[model samples]
Target: MEGECIHIRRLTEGSMSYGNFYWEFIKTNTPVIVTGVSIKWECSNWLLKHGQENNIYSSEINFDYLKQQIGDRLVVVTKCSTHDESTVSVEMQFHEFLNYWRNQILSSKADVNNVTAPKILYLKDWHLKAQLPNYEFYKVPQYFASDWLNEYLEEHKLDDYRFVYMGPKNSWTPLHIDVFGSYSWSTNIYGRKKWILLPPGEQFKLLGPRGSLPCNIKEEMLIEKSVNFLIIYQHENETLFVPSGWYHQVLNVTDTISVNHNWFNGTNIKYIWCNITENLRKVMNEILEFRQYVNFKEDCQQILKCNFGLNISDFLEILCFIANSRLTLYMKRYRSKDMSGNRKSVNSHPDNFHIHYDLKSINMLSKFIAQDKIVFNCSTLYDRCMNLIDITQEIFLER
Candidate 1:
């Protein structure tokens, strides 16, 4: 049986209750479901029928066949899935097929026998434009521009921070937060999606051991964990609101079609900017390391100055802030009790200093000018350090 739709009343009531109980929680981050948003299923069916009448099947067609019929064009994956039991399991680009049909008729290749056939039937492209190594020759269609979705975007005031994601069945969007400084809402229009969410404090455990930046979880691990949570929905159009700072992984349970919008109002603008600044710092560090090893300092410096318009020192400060924040958050979550003990034992400098020998702490300090600079007087930084000590003390005291 199809899943029940998430009604407006339920959303309003639930958000109100949840918003109050978790007022601090919702202010920082939360997730909610909204239903009866649009008639996406009807639109999906309409596109499918149009493809059949035009003798066009996107999955069974190749780029060569399309080029022969319609020249070059952008083909967006509107639906996909690995579950053969699901109706939308087969991935297809309806608009691409439609474009091919129209071009074929204009080019007088309308005869069914004359149309070029592909050797491989299922020619699916799963990579998004940004994910592609080279985006010059490829283009992604904007499924978010559908009339129904556009209307919702207008009502919700999210027209600016919109993006389209297309993936094959069973593909995973790894655990990460969004960029562009906005809270996001993702809706499943054509198939099922399973999501596993982690609160901010819990994020350290999953990422720290892996030695990964918050934005860069290994895709394979994300896919495995998300599939384990596999939630199925055969009907009812629904959207999931993902508040700022919530780490989540999504698995397209079937060949799926979905649209996502990210929006920043007065509430989340500061936090969103903080997230972007953190990401930029990570990217800069990677570039700097590459330049040092490759002896391309001059070339890299030019790119940094010309492209990013930032000098090395300014960039280094940002990097320091991001690294300190990550370490602070990690230690706070994992070693808070030790922090308290160190505070109490400050008189015994040598003994308390031994805590600095912890590899993670040492490594973090090594990256900065000195321990003092590394632990600068930012409240978030200071709280994280104390929290780390507290966590460590609890563990050792137990032992």
Candidate 2:
């Protein structure tokens, strides 16, 4: 089913504190739209001049400025009209894509009877921050500051989840969940986007033969199948928080540019763990004939990594790092206690509750990991997981 009505809450930038946002929206797995949030970001210069109207700033992307900064850089663009999935992705210079964008814009304004539909090209997943280290365009808002996935990736010098997406009108992404079932936030720097979000577990209703999700969902398909979904219209300088396990499709209502990130932290780490374990079980079942082999478990882990982008070891490492980091903060707070038979208040740290929540979640995950036969067989990994749990427990005791 499709086009079912579900309300998406709207909030202003200053309406709620980070803690409130986490408990109300994040823990509840609700989507929200925040306005007036990205208006002052350095990236906004791409969208607006020095004026405002009806609380909505109006301007298109500054193509000349963008070209000056990254015109010659190579970028990946997807041809939405291509029938062959294998050849859909093509690499080209940014300026060349801009030329295509100009043509698409012109075609959008041309008489329908006289003009042919332009090739809908979408430039997505550009790692702009990694490509230009000194180009600081925007800061992560406080509500999304607990991003553990990108933190681990950046620490290990791996690729980041931060991305810039640009496309002309009607360019869209197919319905899909975020990688690793992490939460994501997308902020429009210019133009507008229409988002159709299917809530957790509702995507199963839209599955086709062989259990594949449809490439392009059609209104007629909603007659037989049934699903509850929300439609969100995101405007320039507005950010959308998409919770874990939500399947979503985004279409550019106008020519658009946006920044997005996929991340997970304590708030939804259990969901992340569950997703990994479920995928691992599927992988093992698919290759059941190889179970007798000595390296079957390891091979499965690698295959999971190949398909899902992370495996058991990677999960444990992330857990250990986050556990240690939170424990260190806890210890520093503990040491700051007064010697006059009274302890210093830990509430001085704005994120005290968040830090404790992270440690607790990590500890819980570690206990689960310790019980897994595959992880228990690896001595080094087993010790690391156990030690992390113990450290988190000690920190809780001290608190």
* Top lDDT prediction, candidate number: 2
Candidate 1 TM-score, C-alpha based: 0.40
- State the lDDT of candidate 1 residue by residue for 1-399, as single tens digits: 112112211242224332232233334455656554444333233223224446633422232532443344444432322222122233445455544434543444455473653111122232332233243322112211112222333444432334544343465554566554346666555556777655454455555465864443433544543322212232225667666766666676544556566554324534543453454455557686574565454454455455544434333333334334434644565454453323234323322323332323323432332233323433444445454444433334453
Best by TM-score: 2
How many angstroms is residue 90 displaced in model 1 relative to the true structure, after the best TM-score fit? Answer: 19
Stretches of model 1 off by over 4 angstroms after superposition: 1-28, 40-72, 75-160, 166-168, 208-210, 213-235, 279-399
- Stretches > 4 Å off in candidate 2: 1-3, 48-57, 82-87, 111-114, 337-350
Candidate 1 accuracy as lDDT: 0.42
For each candidate in turn, the TM-score is 0.40, 0.91
lDDT score, candidate 2: 0.81
lDDT of 2 by residue, 167-275 (tens): 9887888777999999999999888899988888887888878988876665446435667878889988889999999988788888999999999998788888888
For candidate 2, report its TM-score. Answer: 0.91
